[model samples]
Target: MEHFVVSARKYRPQTFKDVVGQQAITNTLQNAIENNHLAQALLFTGPRGVGKTTCARILAKMINSDGSEATSEEDFAFNIFELDAASNNSVDDIRNLTDQVRIPPQVGKYKVYIIDEVHMLSQAAFNAFLKTLEEPPKHCIFILATTEKHKIIPTILSRCQIFDFKRISVKDAKEYLKYIADEQGIQAEDDALHIIAQKADGAMRDALSIFDRVVSFSGKNLTRQAVTENLNVLDYETYFTSTDLILQNKIPELLLQFNSTLSKGFDGHHYISGLASHFRDLLVCKNPSTIELLEVGEQTKVIYQEQAQLASQEFLLKGIQLANDCDLKYKTSKNQRLLVELCLMQLASITFDGEKKNSKHFIIPPSYFKSKGVAPIPVQRPDTISEQPQEPISKEPVTEIKEVPEEVQKPVIEEVVSTPEPVINLSITKPSKSSSGLSLSSIKKKKEHLIKQMDVIIDEEELPKDDFTEEQMVSVWNEYAQRLDKKGEKIMASILQMDVPKLRDNKICIELSNSTLKVELERAQYPLMKYLRKSLNNYDIVLDITVNEEIEKKYAFTTQEKYEKLKEKNPNIELLKKTFGLDI
Candidate 1:
């Protein structure tokens, strides 16, 4: 078998231009070499694998200027020493290095020393090197590299020039990965490369490692499925499927997909994490400026752009929230599957249109996402009730109600005449102290809202005689059932099910399942009575709520009892039946 060197090492960038997505750092380094204005002690710090040590090596090569392998001792232009502080962290090592620094460069004008992971050095070693580091020999230079800059003492940081290496952009990383893929003559799908880039997460070395591992599994033919499966990645297909279902508002289908994912052996937490990342990508892909941050293959990028066109920012935001909620609740939930299922259910309900209200706060249409600002969310109070239908009153009350038209009454005038009902505030909108120590505007707004509500209530005072029909009563039951569901009151909903209500003599008699329900009805009796009296001008007609036996239990008829009832009810009917020659 022929030994195959992985694409990562084979296609490693030799020149500064080849380094991915870090132009700023490369340019600064190149400038320092060209100007001969290099700092003696340089500190390179940032996240791991973002080219801190790599840049240091590059810097070392530039300083010494050896053959193609600038790392060789024979190629040393001066005296350039490279040390791994993780291993050579003793005071003896530092003392020896310091002693050697006093000697002049053997071959070149200035000597260079490079130390990787300098934070690993012992306190005594750092103390030993401090004096030489602060004011070293004129012919000597020093370079220090670390992933965690904070671990290094501030004293050391102040003495050396600091250069921060930023994370490589996804766009920049993809280009480099492409260069490698093309160089290796590998048949890698764009999505395959995108998976490698995403897995790398802005580290060139890590990207290379992932690419190598994937190549080993895929051989020369790198397919999207091969890469994702080998690396245990959640495929873009899953996200695409989920997002499409959500956009279509298919909650059941969404949950089915979620169950399918779980059956495939995917972790709930991982699913949530990927969804968050996917949403993040969609957010970044919203504008041209942010698209550069989206790290995926060219083909996948196109797919994302298409989806972004399909998805609104509002949808992404709400969908992401649902996904995040699933993640947070995943661990604590006893029935983990149900928790995840609920999340998908919630996600499917999210409409990008401004009309979809935030389950958290306000409801706005998805169209609102397109606009520059948000429409204020309407207030909701927990105990608040909407206006009830008109009452059925006697003919006299109808005439009184007909008299109050043709008035655009103002609040300021109305408040003085009638005591205004207080506005229902579900949220705490407590007035804050203002310049004069009282917020009159806030108080006025509350009072005004209250007055308006009272006016609406007063408007329903005019009742027609025998106003509500059975159909109307059933409709009210259904509406209240839905309201109870929204409030998570299943108990109340079940009782409302026995609500085959009828309008009897202007009073509503709702059949109950049992006396328990009848008791609940009685508890609600006062509000029901007041509302009925107001809606129907029949104060004399009282509600005769009863637990009707037929409503309570379903019974079967026995043959003997049926005969007895028939015989008792009609003695003359028997003689007439005998005359008619009738048989039972």
Candidate 2:
């Protein structure tokens, strides 16, 4: 059997028209040759496997072939000189090349020198080659290729014609692969070729190599399933199924699917990152103009559009955010699997009701009334039993109590029972202490009358007026600060502790350090004033707060000022600074 050659070397482009994804550069070079406007030195810079060296060789052959198409590589072997600078990067190597440049071409009109990885040349070598590059022989042409143009000195760049080659696009690579498959009589699917293109990441050589590997593994027929299995890539159906389950709020199914995926030795972070990308693709499909941005096969694109119709824009955006956040936190979390599960739960519950339930407080029992010897007297209705004594129901509303007279105040409780027609409201009060032979019904009537009388007295009561001293006001102010501290308001407590209350014109004035303190004190003014009045028996007390600007002026202006202050507090600081010879 004859030796087998790899696809990368066997299928390399020979003519300018055959180069993929580099039309602009090829067109420029060809036009320059056809018009006889070729430069002495040319620099080709770009990523690897982008047809830089190949273009250099093709240009060299075309210059000697009178701009004619040269399909065979052996046509220009005599005039073309290829150098690997990675091995021969020294002053001697450059000296030998410059010596060769002085001689004329034997087989062609011009000699083309092609240097690969030219950035690897030593500084002395580059210096030695600069003179020849600036003004070369009339019969010599230099072509330098490098992946890193920045490493080349500016002097070298300014002396040559520069051409930047871009990476091969996926569309171009996939079409080239299809042509090759047809030539080889192999059956292939669109999705299988697309996978190979994506795996190449804009490198034509890499794509061809991957295509050859898959063919060797899956025989003559190339299928999507075979490509995915061979490359160990997660299937597109995995992401589609996961998204459908999340949209339907099927948490259990999603978890089981994730578990199954993990069992196959796939990383959780990769899965989540892929999920985020899937969401991004869905968002792109949301708009008709952006549909082309999604890079997938035709069938996969249709599936994405159908799913994008079901997923709301807000849901898709939020899902992307959640997945990205989970991916970032996955490496730091101790329980990685639990974190992912929790994220899934939160995503599923995003549309749940957010209004929390309010806790209900139970009412105090009626045993207090019974313990005070007060029984609830029930007013009999016509439909009720006639055996119990009939008590007349009072038709008055209950009022707030102030002070009840001894003559009418009685310990009596009324129980309201539901009758066939109407519900009677009742009142319960303290019972009488004397043996006055008062029945339950009469005591209930007296309690009701006294409750109304007390309301009238309270409405007519007078307000109290008292005076508090400065010391008493300061004492109560500090007490309030302690209370705030106990309630976990440390900043408020610190504000109060740092300021003191002053007496002015029969009123209390509160002094604070800054505006922040003033605002905090203002929020609690009402409650604090109420507490002070009840404590000091002075309801007419007044408080005025002002920020003292003079106090804030005492702060340090610079490091020197702070050091001086420290020196005043500790004289040994000066001695320490002098010993260390410190400067401000």
Candidate 3:
């Protein structure tokens, strides 16, 4: 049996030339070394395992390099001082480092001090090293390395020339890993390395660590399956297949895919999230410039490319939106699976502009009216038959109201509805209320002509006239409505829009088509009535609200809906079978 070193340590870089994915920082350092324009202190900061400490070590070895690795005895002593701040983080240790700072280097011209995790140093240690750091010995150079640069004090930061190391990009990381694997003559797949790079999450050392593990699991030969299975990753195949089903409207196949993934222990949320990320990748792949930034195995990339090629730009756009919305709604959702399933179903049905079932409050188009076969009807006044003349000389509404006999009414009332919880008959697309058989114009005439005659005579005998114009009074009314609206009085705002106001027999009458609007308007009558009478110089005014018919727009059911209801009432004598073994 042979013991193998992990790739993280085995393939570690020894010089600035060998450092990966930090060309900007390395180039700057090489330039500084070549020009001999190095600062007294250098700070290296970035994410974990991205070559901070390795670069510091390389810098130390290079600056302290002697004639030979074997012959120079002084190379062992003052050439490099590597300190781990995590362990030696006290004031005494820093004081000792400061004391040793005065000595000139024996082997190299300059002694380099590299402090790893420098942010771990105590406050007292930082304070002790402040002066020595700002003004170190002529023979000494300082290099501080940290994963979190923000934790380091600003005073210390000012003394050093900072170099920020970036995360190893997926492309660079994949390429480097391939180079290493090929050099070792290891059989590996490009997708395997790509997975390792993605899992590395911008850290070179982490990438190498994952590479080492995969190599062990795969022995001398590497396969894409080994990498995905070992890493517990759900491949792009599931996403591609599911999305295809959704796009083709194959909901059964979509659910089958979901059930299989769930049975494999993939969570509903993770599955949805992966679906979201997959759609996002497709979106990115559709664009030329951003495609390079996407992280995926070669096979996955190919799959994405194929989908991107086949899918319309609009399909990808809306699919991504639905997936993202599902992801956001997943946490708080009670039926999470259904939520994801519904999103998938909607995504499958989504056309470029989406299906245009009328939105709530969305007006019906002319085409819809034409399809429903609705025509404008003339308004008719109520008429009585000559035989019913002795019934009454009533001037009330004339709509036919059915009267229920007492014996038959109880069961009808009892059977009207019965449920454990009250069911609210609300509509997402239905117009709220049906129009009453009344007209606004008729109501306005009765208001202005009749109310004005009686109120004008009484107004002259009341308080002073010419105090306020009708518009000013309306503005006052509107202001009151505005104030009420700011206090979450939306109903008041709706009532204010009714707008018709008239005075009859020294009383103010306001006509509203909506009963709810009328109720809300009546609530404001006490304060508004007082304000109006005071402002109008007419104390003989009372506020009255009546329902107006003109604004009461009809709420009609669609032809399809009406047909469905009629069919439900009688049902089909025979079971109607639809396509694909489904009966509707």
Candidate 4:
């Protein structure tokens, strides 16, 4: 039996050319070595598993091997020295290294020292190593590698040439993993490799580790399902199914899907976040230029593009927002499951208009009842008597409404607006009739009458316009601001209170303190302008808003500012501060 070795260690890059996802850095080093322009001290820094230490080792070997690959690790043992700075980060360890640097190499013309995680060195040790780095012996080279470049002192950094390593891209990592799988004679799916690459997050070492683990679990055959199962990753199929349910406004189905996911031990927060990503991917696929941004398997991407076609850009954007909001609120929500379920319901209703005007702020579509038809639960309006004079109050047959599916009835809701009638204020109790007693013909007549009345109400014409003075406009503006304040729009009210509108020709020009206020006012421009026009009796009152970028800066709100203000009021305050040695 052979001893087991992880793929990360077994396939570590042995040559500069063998290194993946670092062409620029590797090419620069290769050119320097070829031209004999190698810096005595070189610093390689970047995130972990991005080939910092690996490159350091490769560079050390290549320099001593005359820019050729060494046949074996033992061949460079005499000339190459490696130190773990994490454990040996002390002045004494550095002194010993400095002593070793003075000795001439026996086998090669140059001697190399590779220090891993060099930033782990203390300030004193770094200072001690500085002199040797700045001016080393003629035949000695120093290669320092670290994941954190900021921790290293500037003095040491100035004396060395820096090489920043970037994370291996998903494409490059996938290719490398495929190459490894091919070499191992294992059959691997592209989606499986893509998932592993994404899971690695730009780290080749992590990717290889994941690949080995997956291979061990599933033998030599790898599939998307196997990888997802082993890694506990949320399946893309789940998202696709959920999106279909949402597009159909199937609230019950979406909630069931969420419940199924939760049953698999996936966190609610994770599920919601994944849902947001799924929507984002769909949105990205909607554009040609942005399609490349969608990171998924080729087959999965095709599915995404297909799903993207089913959803409008507006629906995708709103779905993403609702999912993100659910994710953000999932943590603090008292009923975590309910929060996610509500977000799912909102997503299911993204394209729905079943909710009434009273609950317009809420994103809830009609709740589907299994017992009733597919139509959303309709909210009953309070009955009111008409003020119009009639011959007499007649007893009429109640109307019976047909059960229509919500999707089929959505258009009717958009086309019909309920008309308000004056209440009779009758206190007398009346016997109630059952829905079964109502006739369909009577219901049809009542609906027709309601629609006709709504049409008449909507077709009503505006009053004739009359010119008004600037004083009247100002009064209306103030009144509008008061109305906004009453509606709990304090920010908008404050903005309106800050500036008075000026009548320039026929246009009403309003200046705001900042662009934020300007945007808010512009968003509500139609309604605000309509109210002002109605109150001032001017139909042609055009609103023009301008943002003043050079708004006056306000005083600081810190305790230091308060202390400084106090100091200016009394000279004795400074003396007291000096006596007490207070920190301000």
Highest lDDT: which candidate?
Answer: 4
* Runs off by more than 4 Å, candidate 4: 67-69, 73-75, 355-361, 365-584
Ranking by lDDT: 4, 2, 3, 1
lDDT of 3 by residue, 136-177 (tens): 888889999999999999999999999999999998899999
TM-score of each: 0.59, 0.63, 0.61, 0.66
Better of 2 and 4 by lDDT: 4
TM-score of 2: 0.63
lDDT of 1 by residue, 359-416 (tens): 4533232232333343343243335556677355343311111222234334433663
**List of clashing residue pairs for candidate 4:** 375-406
Predicted structure 3, TM vs. truth: 0.61
Position 61, candidate 4: lDDT: 75
Winner on lDDT between 1 and 4 is 4
RMSD in Å for all candidates: 25.1, 15.9, 25.8, 15.4
Q: Which lDDT tens digits does candidate 4 get at residues 113-192?
A: 88998999999999999888999999999899998899999999999999889999999999999999999999999999
How do the residues 1-584 of candidate 2 rate in per-residue lDDT, one tens digit apiece? 99988888888888988899999999999999989899999999998888999899889889899545454555556888999999999999999999999999877689999999999999999999999999999999999999999999988999999999998888889899998889788899988999899889888889999999999999889999999989887888999998888776666778899999999888888888888899999999999999989988898899999999988898888888888999999999999998887777656544332222121211112232232354344444456434677457556523333454554334322212233344332232442343221335456777686445431212212446577777888898889889989999898788777767787865777777678878988887888888787788866676788888776666426788888889899999999889999886
**Which has the higher lDDT value, candidate number 1 or candidate number 2?**
2
Whichever of 1 and 3 has more TM-score, that candidate is: 3
